[model samples]
Target: MAKKKKTPNDKNVMAQNKKARHDYAILDTYEAGMVLTGTEIKSIRARRITLQDGFAQIRNGEAWLMNVHIDEYAEGNRFNHDPLRNRKLLLHKKEIKKLQDAVSDKGITLIPLRIYLKNGVAKVLIGVAKGKHEYDKRETLKRRDQQRQIDRVMKRY
Candidate 1:
């Protein structure tokens, strides 16, 4: 019998909202499928996507991703989809209910963390987050600075 080698993940991340992690405390994360057009997928494949100001909302028992901008494919021409259109997120009914309940609480929000392809399918990592206060954000910055200083000191030894 021949030995098989494991392949590393080569899926390219389309876009990531790094600010979301810095500005918000993520309580839970869920991977949900995104409904995209053919051109949209092509655009995503080319990494022409932005998730800086994107969010997820549970409406009418379904999840919708809003403000996710996928640029038009240069080769698609007239068949290209809208740039900032709302895309539906595919989640199970039970998971949707859970997310809706968590979102209903005060001071909690739905933030899109990143968009990536898993097994050739587009998936969005949605985070259940709570906005951080100014002092909290400052504390995070302080800790990060302290950690950097410690790393520098250790590297010199």
Candidate 2:
């Protein structure tokens, strides 16, 4: 008898913020647990989420994720949570203090890069990033264009 090929089980992925990496220089990354309501969790599990305009902020020694939109579950009733409400991020006190100090050093900002489900719980991967200056952005574009050109040349050779 032939053995059947196994299918890899991947945790559900909700959303990603691709532009954050392009526009900011990522310094540090942290995986934070998200506080979610039943409806929000359900929505995330269904892959109904958006992170394009999402961000993170440190307030009162705590990390709060803002602008992440988890659409209401299709079957949700009046118990649905607000789509754009600020969600508390679960992080250690020491991590919060470290992030706070890093931000105080200037040019550092908290950016929510992606949101995914791990072990059936939703989590957000946040990064400590600094905004890239115009020159840096231009250099990135130049490098990308050069790489594309090199690939094209190699393919024809």
Candidate 3:
């Protein structure tokens, strides 16, 4: 049997924060399991989650996913989870310690890069990123355009 290949567009990926890639220079990434409520999981399975302004933080020896918006499950009655609640991220103690140390550095922060389901479990990919300057953003775009042009030319041959 062939090993399954993974891509950004993998069928398991439910939501992606493309804006996070544009706004931050990601240095490192970690995959973490999410502790979701019943309705939250339902909403996520329906592709009703947003990662636009979502971030992660290491607080008091635990990791927390903040500002991620998972819409309420329509069938849920009064037991619906809050759309903007801070959800717990399940990572090892060593990982949490390392993340805390990395976040302690000036100008470094944690941002959720994407959310994907792995083996029926919801997981989040968080990035340790540094803010890019305006000029840096422009440079990145220019590089991207040049790469596209190169690909186009190569494809013609």
Candidate number that wins on lDDT, 1 or 2: 1
C-alpha TM-score for every candidate: 0.90, 0.85, 0.93
User: Which residue pairs in candidate 1 collide?
Assistant: none
Better by lDDT, candidate 3 or 1: 3
Ranking by lDDT: 3, 1, 2
Return the top candidate by lDDT: 3
Alpha-carbon lDDT, every model: 0.91, 0.87, 0.92
Runs in model 3 lying further than 4 Å from the true structure: 1-9
TM-score of model number 3: 0.93
CA shift at 70, candidate 3, in angstroms? 0.7
- Per-residue lDDT of 8 in model 3: 47
- C-alpha positional error of residue 15 in candidate 1 after TM-score superposition, expressed in Å: 0.5
lDDT per residue as tens, model 2, 104-154: 878888988888777777888899999998899999999999999999999
Cα misplacement distance, residue 50 of candidate 1 (Å): 0.8
